[model samples]
Target: MGQQTRAHLTGRKIYGCGRCGTHLTTVEALLSKRFTGKFGQATLFYSVVNVLEGPPEDRRMTTGLHTVVDLRCLKCETYLGWKYIKSFEQSEKYKENCFLLERALLQTIEPGLELEGAEDPISREGNDSSTASNLQEEDDDDDDDDGDDEDE
Candidate 1:
């Protein structure tokens, strides 16, 4: 769940998974997208939330795999994406401190106070929103391999 403004939707703040919005650590969490082939090369995107335990499961695989852990919606268990547990590259180890959010799964939250009686806005489902489909991953990783290794 996150927000990265594209051309048409300029200056808009977005959030994802309405049920888990409260679980979000920051609206401005750094976003990173990369094909580590560890999580799925199609481009894994997620937002940095907080430090998490590097659980001792799903810990072995291809060389240079980012030691990342899967992050899920704390309430409903939706697979939001992964967070950096550690990195394999020493030069880029700072990435071990961010989250890579899936842009498609995200929705936008109004930047300021909600109008009276109005429900907090949620984006259309990823399958239905053209605007959302067009959203792109803006930030790049510091280039050391991203973090987190998935564990159930």
Candidate 2:
């Protein structure tokens, strides 16, 4: 008999937020339920960054997903989201899947960018009172040099 081999079942893998590291389990679960009935019926590719599962193995080991929407900040190389291959029917052809969350649902999953008052602490604090106060003071001092502007 030919050697028997085990076949692995392929399924969706969930991810967490890049900035906050918040798990997207609930979001992925909900999307899985929603898409279970809609596979291969529509063109559903959308923009999203590929968050790799682990560190790069070599110099050429870029996150090898289908479509990488954005290259996140180098200081914090967090993957945002990505489109995944759903199925392969031909040698060079494959089906893909993506999540289409409602504005509310997207906000729930990635609230900081998708909703008001959902920004991260660093982003919020960057424009908060202390920083704003310093900028205002700088503007006030700049206004005192009226002759400097005319000379230029």
Candidate 3:
């Protein structure tokens, strides 16, 4: 499972599935959608936790809890999306003061809709235009050759 820093939700449907009409509110449903190419796959990972005091490197304790999610293909195990869970201390004066973090972060990576053995739109357009121009140039060359033959 590879980790991506960016988030993507291209194929992700904000509503339910069109085929089975399954609601995508739960993590399991989301995972299933990801695996089936409905929402697209992405690797979710825990990076770090930040406290109000400062980062752990600044003499502050980095005891915050963190969680990560990995989006992978069920069949081929390809990484796709990332989810993070973080918690921090609510106060500094309270020695034993800590609360469950109420915040959640989600990230997704979509590599664009892929079709087997088919080129993307941008590539296809360039190829078509180039081929057309090349054919035109060849026609011009043939015309010049014919004119030279006549002169000879």
RMSD to native for every prediction? 9.0, 20.9, 23.5
TM-score (C-alpha, index-matched) for candidate 2: 0.22
Best-first order by TM-score:
1, 2, 3
For model 3 the local lDDT of residue 34 reads 9
Residue-by-residue lDDT tens digits, candidate 2, 38-75: 11111122323322333222111122223212222222
Query: Model 2 segments beyond 4 Å from truth?
Result: 1-30, 33-77, 90-116, 119-152
lDDT by residue for model 3 (1-152), tens? 56422222234322111112121121212211101112322211122111122122212224333333333322223332333323244532221221111111111112342222222222344442442243234333323221111000
Each candidate's TM vs. the true structure?
Answer: 0.50, 0.22, 0.19
Q: Best lDDT goes to which candidate?
A: 1
Among all windows of 10 consecutive residues in model 1, the one with the lowest summed lDDT is 4-13
lDDT of 2: 0.27
Off by over 4 Å in 1: 1-12, 18-27, 31-63, 113-126, 129-131, 137-152
> Model 1: per-residue lDDT, tens digit, 2-79?
642221211334444333342343334433344343223323334433223334333443434457676665444556
Distance from true location, Cα of 89 in model 1, Å: 1.8
lDDT of 3: 0.24
